[model samples]
Target: MHTRTRVVAFQPPVCRIVWAPRFAVKSASNKNSRRASQHEVKAATLTNLSSDRTERRSFVDCASEDTLHHPSQLPDDRQILQGCESVRAPLNVAVLLSGGVDSSFALHLLNRAGHNVQAFYLQIWFQEDFRNYWDSCPWEEDLSYCQQVCKDADVELHVVPLTDEYWDRVVAHSIAEIKAGRTPNPDILCNSRVKFGAFYEYLASHQDHNFDRIASGHYARIIRGDDPDEPVRLALAPDAVKDQTYFLAHLTQPQLSRVMFPLGSLNKAEVRALAKAAGLPNQARRDSQGICFLGKVKFSEFVEQHLGVWPGCIIEEETEEVLGYHQGFWFHTVGQRRGVPLNGGPWYVTQKDVHTNTVYVSRNYYSVDKERNLFTCESVNWITRPPDSASQVLCKVRHGPVLYKCDVSFTNGDQSAVAVRLECNDQGLASGQYAVFYQDEICLGSGVIQTTGVSHAEIGSFVDDQTKAVL
Candidate 1:
């Protein structure tokens, strides 16, 4: 005799199940063996079905169709899905589209992942004269690309004119820093003040549109801290070579909590691959270089336009010889080599005396000193909680992958300001430049370089007698 049995299958909320019926063969002598074989076959069938469900789940959670076509080539769906549930949810999100490969890919990924995404391009450059000076000003082209991408993704694109805000907050601050003989990274201020600050405020205030979070294509990660008391932390991107964490060190806890970086785990190569796979038009487009707001104009040209050139003398540090002259001390920064009219060989601006209107130069650009290794920073903004006092931490004086070992000690009994002592020699430390602090891969916070310490001997040797007399 033969008995028929029905197998009912079910899956999670994401998928549906199917039912099938099969007949079981029975015999008197071989009944037990036959039954055992039937049971084994049934168990194997269920196992296979479970695997199919897993593959589908991987597709959904990973949010990349490339995984389905070439699973081995992409990262494990589990790894990509980690800490991404909030992003995968079908909530209203505002994406900052820069008409670049990264931002376009971000918009596509969020849309595919079932999120309600809207695209925004902040028009920060309003100067029409930029076209006259800069040959590569791609603002018009960039906006066109943004529009096409948004249209393809069926997302509405909004062009917000932030020119006034950008000039007021970021551009003004950078010009001020340059005039005061400090190196300022305007991108940092743009991210903190405009993108996450002003843009976010605009979106949140709208009664008609309720966005839960803002997303960008920046190559950095924001994750919940291990300690409950600590706020969310900003971390380095998985692709160290393309990490943008330094520019985001000034972001506050609230800003970080409300923002998402879709390209956090992806390298540049992976981003390009995904863009190509998704048919993004800007897949092969070149990445933007230099300052974001400056467009095609050179930094020196832009500075010179606003802050007119004031002619000054350049003195060699060692012999106090008049090596050459500079248009303005504000136009040159410490460790700058070019634009100094010198003939013998390469010369670097070692120091600037604003009082005497003199620039100091040295042949040994890589000169190491105790003063260069130590400096003080103010207006420190911590990403998470402040680290223990006098703790050993890593510091990045610029927006590169290089990290210098340093010890941080609070100054004037103020936690917001600190003195950093680098363990190794590093040149080009400028006032107004940010000293981004870190503990391993986590971005701790950042501060403005208020002043740098130089040995009296080093200063006196380089500065002219007239400048030293004033000092």
Candidate 2:
């Protein structure tokens, strides 16, 4: 450990796995959304006070309700720890445990580092009254895993239940966003709604529990700070080999302040070495892949299981011929290839007409690309404030890739910067994803792509926005 940074709390807001450190530190970080619905607008106005300099967004970990033999839920288990409203403490830290390699390692490292540490697991939900993962894991699920880790660390263990309401509000909204042709920011929303909203809100109700910092198993970083005197906003981890900033660009300064990334300074190999040296049983455990806490299931597949769908048609890009049919229009994306019925040619999914199950396809970008280089987004959350009137900054379409030089512009309302044109085009880019701007790897802020325009070649002085903008 590079003498890990001391924990800092933001008053009672210690919610969201994203606000933690696991998926957060990629240890060569490769990588790096959204509008204000009514729910988001409400969150913006809420704030809390702290008991100490280290008050985190305070939250509780409620146990679950289970069947006969497995009485996981303990009724009449209400306890209040106070001024929990904010999470900004310096002496204590919490690591979200999922019983996987990343989180396990994170828990062990933090415990050993001598910080006041505890382990927590948010209970996952079940379908048709069946929870598939409760006992299948090699170690216990996050809940018990946290318990064991806490016992060893001489700390408390917390278990937050993933209630039915969470699926309806968080999961369902995520599906709806993706289906609406928007690159749904589920992990981001999950943090805001469940972790921050329900968990922190409830945790704040307590009058005694006070911890300062929250950590997780994410693989991203915070580069610059909201306040120059403070730590920089999270950045790609130092290892750079397995960065996950792409999935975490939505972190705002409010969340960043109370967050810590202990593994941010280490690589997977180093973590394994530490785990092995510590004789942790799960030292040899393989790192879990895919979205943190979300699991290995494909995004589209999961959405389909919950969302009802209707079949639709596929159309040829140039000829407008009805090539074939598909299961549902929502299942495909602008640059996707699978799920679209084969038509004997090297066909790719080029467009989706949601009103009708009509997909458009073509052999090349010129024929089927409909993205606009210039697009708009709302409810802007920026970590770095651009110099006033300094309109241009290098921006990145996503993580993994470096930022590109561009001219930046915003809408008249300027709710968020509305448009950016790359110095040039990149092939096969699509709309509805995210376009995060960066200044030398430091993420300024990010936005959902509304449209992408391209400029076609060979027609001098006659370039359309679609042809000019790369998608």
Candidate 3:
């Protein structure tokens, strides 16, 4: 006899489930439109697992009879289950939803695998003082989508307000780094600090609710040894282009221990196909870009708003000539070509003098003679333990599929600092940028780039003091 698998709305505890009378769900006919009319939905009650008290949550049963796939047509559980090698059966999972197709699909997979899943939408967008940012972060629309997804899966959804935590942990650090003339990746901090950091802390305080593991839509894999004491190592996803292990490099062993990435084995195309086949509401939705907190707000605007403006000079590195002027030195980073106004030709930012408030540019930014591969990383965070000196490893200077084969050595017996020498040249190395380390497919950890070996002396002849002063 053959058993059949089907998409379902799992039944929860005896606690009541109600759809808030005021909560409006988008109608099926106007699904794609932002201003879609509200569909008539009955009220149901779902116990709020995020809070200490028994708070009543209105759950709208938005599961569409027409949209759901037939039992035989649903995606095979094996595709997702293959990644959960260490997962025990019937786990109480807390899933992080971003109102996107990926997270929604992960939730569906978990439900199909016989796990009890609860969804949480984190509110970390700018508010109050920064309310003017992008009219607003389009969070209401995102929340609506989250509610609909939860309703369809028959899972309880909770909205956790974490704006303060986000600003304190991620944004503050980013702003400070910018002011100090260093580049910082807030997304990395967001994953380590807010999504996984603050959210974990929030859940820990709620004694009444105890979740076995946290699941997310991140395209990264985790490999666990059979021994309970063995370290849980982070691995790369099959989707090279969409792999997010770089952002997750800062995560600790404890964080990795309680986390689950269900989309690890699938690529972007496969995810889209599975989502479409599953008839998910956001199956056709485009992937989000840039920093999450910024939303529709531009990065430049955010920088200007917080750091204000301080005019500075843009000097050519070879000639030390004043080619143009910029609003501020903090606004520009090393290797940045865009936004630099120079009439002659293409110029890349080579260096910056924070004291002089000057940005140095160069036309020969990628000159072959200039050795830009060597750099030192400070404040290194090892996922498991520090690697032995001269460990041959692969490192990512930034987020992308590209990984440079390199060697790392500890600095003067300092475990928190490592000197890295990449096998190839990278033009964009700058202070405060993270260099995530890896071995084969397992992610080792990450560190902030402190200094580089990039030198402009051999690139071209320098202008004399007389010529420089005249310009």
Candidate 4:
């Protein structure tokens, strides 16, 4: 653990004058129309507030006392600052600090922007009853780093414990999906249901604090188009590999209206540099992986603890011969190559039977005949507006930089469900995974996968025939 320290820096009364960190900053040519501006206006007054006292350059003019809007108008969540319609004033932002480098750096940016920034650390770690399942909990250390960052930045910090909410919204949903033989993305649910959903509810109930926007270190951008009638659009980050729009696709318009992403323009390397330059305690800290609420516990251990183990046979799909046994069918998923107890060359888990409690494997998992390029998704959430069938789209079945060009059509003449056909065959098409849709850099939205287009009827009948022959 790194030692945490807080250094009180200078703050201006009317507007904070702080040095803009060395990174890409773009200006908005036409403030009224978002289409005219490719990037958000990020230029700020460059003044080093440290003891050395650097030179000041006024790139972004601060709002004078005469121009300052009334304090009462600052808390309106629906009030968006459009050209000539509203005055430019500092925002009251509630930043979600994860104690990671990206989020800590995002706090730095918000503080420099002269917003009334307050930090909140959500504690979703599994403790108490599930304490034994976790080898080590990192939320304590995360909170410590968050405290140090907020202290140095001279901002108030709040620790929001949402364990029960997390369980009800994300963890339980994940458990249910896994038990029913589907891959569930808890991070996606956490963003929509827990972080933005439950947190907003918590803020609303508490009248003492009123925030105009909820900021996070997410690598996504919000584009408010020229027409105020148009919904806010969630765009991809400059860093494609680190873009998190997929996880945030399910968030409602109201949630997105109040969302701010300061690290949207900064790439991973630029973020790291800014953190190191700001003297953050966790500048050198590695990024956290796996499920957000799991802490140090592996996903397999979580499933085993909740669902327990039911011993089942792992049979070869090509042959009805049983090759090995598995602890449970829920533990394995489609296209998983590792953790299977098999020795005859490499084997991939192709299917699982929940009722029979059987796992199916195949040596040639990528055969052309078995390729999956078609699927249907239900519960579709369109971020901006629903696109017509002729619209060009790209789809992501899972997280990462990989995206497949796809075609989409509304099922049964309505938008109740969507059928997606990928241009290329995918090997890991699993039910219950989210199919996030995008058009160019703009994230359209996402949906719950209802069908994987993989059938096991032939295999099931063949296994029964072999069993009868043996008997």
What TM-score, over all chains together, does every model reach? 0.77, 0.67, 0.79, 0.77
Per-model lDDT: 0.69, 0.50, 0.72, 0.69
State, as a TM-score between 0 and 1, how close model 2 is to the true structure: 0.67
lDDT of 1: 0.69
Q: How far off is residue 186 in model 2, in Å?
A: 1.8
Give a tens-digit lDDT track for model 4, residues 207-273. 9879987889888778776875778888876444467888999998988988888777554655665
Q: Model 2 off-target regions past 4 Å?
A: 1-90, 128-144, 222-232, 290-301, 366-374, 387-405, 413-415, 424-432, 454-471
lDDT tens digits, residues 179-272, model 2?
6755565656666566545655545665554556667766555443345467456465533334455555566666666655655544444456
Cα lDDT tens digits for candidate 1, 321-349: 88778889988888777777888767878
Number of the candidate with higher lDDT, 3 or 4: 3
Model 3 C-alpha lDDT per residue in residues 1-471, reported as the tens digit of each score: 211111122232111111111121111121122221123222233322122222333232333322322222223456556554425768899999999889988888888778888999998886546645544566777888899889888999999999999999999999999999999999899999999999999999998569988999998988877897899998877444467898999998998899998888655656777888778888888766577667666788889889898888999899988888988899898888888878776788988998889999988886655657778778898998765444446788887645666766665444677677676566788999999987656788999998876333311122232222110
The C-alpha stretches of model 1 lying farther than 4 A from their native spots are 1-72, 79-88, 128-136, 225-230, 368-371, 389-391, 454-471
Candidate 3 structure, TM-score to reference: 0.79
Candidate achieving the largest TM-score: 3
* Candidate 3: worst-modelled 10 consecutive residues by lDDT: 13-22
